[model samples]
Target: MVAPLRVGIAGLGTVGAAVVRLIEEQARTLSARSGRGIRVVAVTARSKAKKRTLDLRGIDWVKSPLALANNPRIDCFVELMGGSGEPALSAIEAALKNGKSVVTANKALIAKHGLRLARAAEKHGGALNFEAAVGAAIPVIKTLREGLAGTGVNRVYGILNGTCNYILTRMEQEGLSFAECLKDAQRLGYAEANPSFDVDGHDTAQKLAILASLAFGTKVAQSAVYVEGISSIAPEDLRAADELGYRVKLLGVAVRTPKGIEQRVHPTMVPKSSSIAQVMGVTNAVTIDGEGIPAITLVGPGAGGAATASAVVADIADVARGIRAKPFGRPVDRLRDTKKAPMERHEGGYYIRLMARDLPGTVAKIATRLAKEKISLESVVQRHPEGVDATDAAKKASPVPVILITYATSEDAIHRALEAVQRDKVISGRPQVIRIEKN
Candidate 1:
């Protein structure tokens, strides 16, 4: 029988400890399947004396991540440290320089420096596996890097962030405001104590950037991906969406249009009947539209220690089995230069809500502006000023609310029409506009 493949693990945090436990428990089974045993020979963290749940008596404990990456006793480096630069970057670079295979769960690191690391790994003849970086337990990175390698993927997108999905799902179901749902999420540990990154759509955008590179074979560009959060989604919008047979989800959408690639993370209205719309709570779903094969959808837990560690162990199993593939599915030099399409060129349906002065000809004026911009409205619901149905309310008050769902139109047309409505004396405050996704 072949000997065990020595592994070095850095950052014995929640995910790190989970990896260790999983490897130990599944060693025999995995070895039989892979024809080689997998063992964690070396481990490293910030503090050597920190109390850990894993039994580390026989393993080597290093003081720094760099030491673990460069340790000669280990054949593979598993970086579970959660960061984009510094030690994580240095350790990964050191591993590649030393011709050691690497498996990581760092999404930010992949999104920011994936191309560079891919080049380094390819240049040094080392495997760079990061299935855990994009989707916690979905094997999405592997799907794009291997399964869909033969197909032409026009778009790859989904609910990449669980915290945002949790908050949005709660808001839609419980009719809670965005702030209320966010507070509940933080208390439930679905969101961080400082939840700006997840709630602001930046976290999803980062993951989308990484997926976009794999799907399109291009360099990851987190900054180029347009982003918008659910912080501004009001209860009224959620109610309006429900009334329209839709659900509001913070979706990371990417498309390969005739013009170029369009990537965005925003609060979008998806038809409630769609499979993705029903993916509620902290769960995540990714949809990939290929030209030949039917659209593929993966739904599962998108976060947590065990789910993420499952992905890390899968990478380890692949290494043990001698399965190797490019970091981004192709040679670094073959990856396309990302050509980001402008947001204005993005064509899609829209949901618009306007608070207008309750007076004669207000709706007519709004319709006229929309007509001038060639934006056609599909449906409109007018709520009485008393916040009740028009038929039930005896007397209508001032500043009535008007919600309209429009047909497919360019973003520029919608922006122009909304701008014209805001300038009119009939409309009150800025109009609320949310894009409607047809996924």
Candidate 2:
């Protein structure tokens, strides 16, 4: 009889515990699928005495993560300890050095040191699976790396962060302000006390970097992504989007362009009829545009112990089946270096909201500035006080909102025109700008 694949896991957090429980509950089905039994032979965590409901009766408790990684008895090393550096890095390297397959859900580490780790896995001839790193249980990594290996990917974009999506969804549906929604997200445990990582767009940037590499054969570079968070999005913008047949979403988009791959994360205005716009709340979705195949979108729970662990165990099962594909879809040496795409050259339609001064020539001045930058308006709407006439409102000099939808234009031109208008002092506060995504 073939021996069961022995597993050692580091970090007994929610995901690690779920992984153990899942393996135990699905042992029979796993054996049938993988053609061998799977066992959790050893485990380690920072605090072993921490009371957990787990049944570790026969499992060996290792002293530290590095020791568990180096444990010769276990055939696969699972690293749930998150971080871009230190114990997780060294331990993963040791596991790969020992020719033991490694599985992790650490997106930060993958974005930071993926190439180096991939090199180690390649040299040692062991699999380094991180399907949980991008979208939990979505199976996007396999779709890009293996399923679409024959097709050239033109674009891969998605709503990658759950916290941001939840916040935006509430803002659009309930007309809640960003700050108000953020506080509720914290109360509901969807956001961290220090929620800057998710709200400031860096979390989405890290995930986009990984997806961009997989789709384009470019080396993972978190620095290459242009990030803009949803914090600047306003309730008024969401209302305007509803009226204009669009929905505002925090999207991470990586598309192949004439200049190269353009990876960006920001509050995008997508058509209301589009598939991505329909996804709401904490759910996540990814859309891949390839050469000939119809656009494929995978949607599921982006994060959570059970959702994430499903992907983790799926990767472990691949190890049991002796499937060892290169870590980032291709050999590390074959992956090309990724560089940050210049945002100034970005071309797209824009939704601009300006608080224009209710004075004669104010409209003329704004139009002239846009004309100077060669930006043509597709549509424009001006709003006055509910009960006030235009003449009365203009006499009061109260600033009125003037919303402009522009045709395809470069980012630099929009900035230049807005700067000239700002200096002209015809508008109040900063202008609210959102890029439009067509389908």
Winner by TM-score:
2
TM-score, one value per model: 0.97, 0.99
How many backbone clashes does every candidate have?
0, 0
Candidate 1 — what's its lDDT?
A: 0.89
Candidate 2 residue pairs that clash? none
- lDDT of model 2 at residue 226? 96
Task: Give the Cα RMSD of candidate 1.
Answer: 1.7
Lowest summed lDDT window (length 10), candidate 1: 389-398
lDDT of 2 by residue, 1-439 (tens): 8899999999999999999999999999999999999999999999988999999999999999899989999999999989999899999999999999999999999999999999999999889999999989889999999999899999999999999999999999999999999999999999999999999999989999999999999999999999999989999999999999999999999999999999999999999998999999999999999998888989999999999999999999999999999888888888888878899999999999999999999988998999999999998888996888999989989999999999999999999999999999999999999999987
**CA displacement after TM-score superposition, residue 225 of candidate 1 (Å):** 0.1
The best candidate in terms of lDDT: 2
Instruction: Give the per-residue lDDT digits (tens) of candidate 1, residues 1-439.
Output: 7888999999899999999999999988989988999999999988887787789989999878898888999989999988889899999999999999999999999998999998999998889999898779998999988988899999888988999988887887788888888888889899899999999999999999989888988788998799888888898899889888999999998888888789999999999888788898899999999997777999999999999999999998888888779998889899878866778888989999988877777899999999998988899888875546654442353677899888999998988888888888777778889999885
- Name the runs in model 1 displaced over 4 angstroms: 385-397
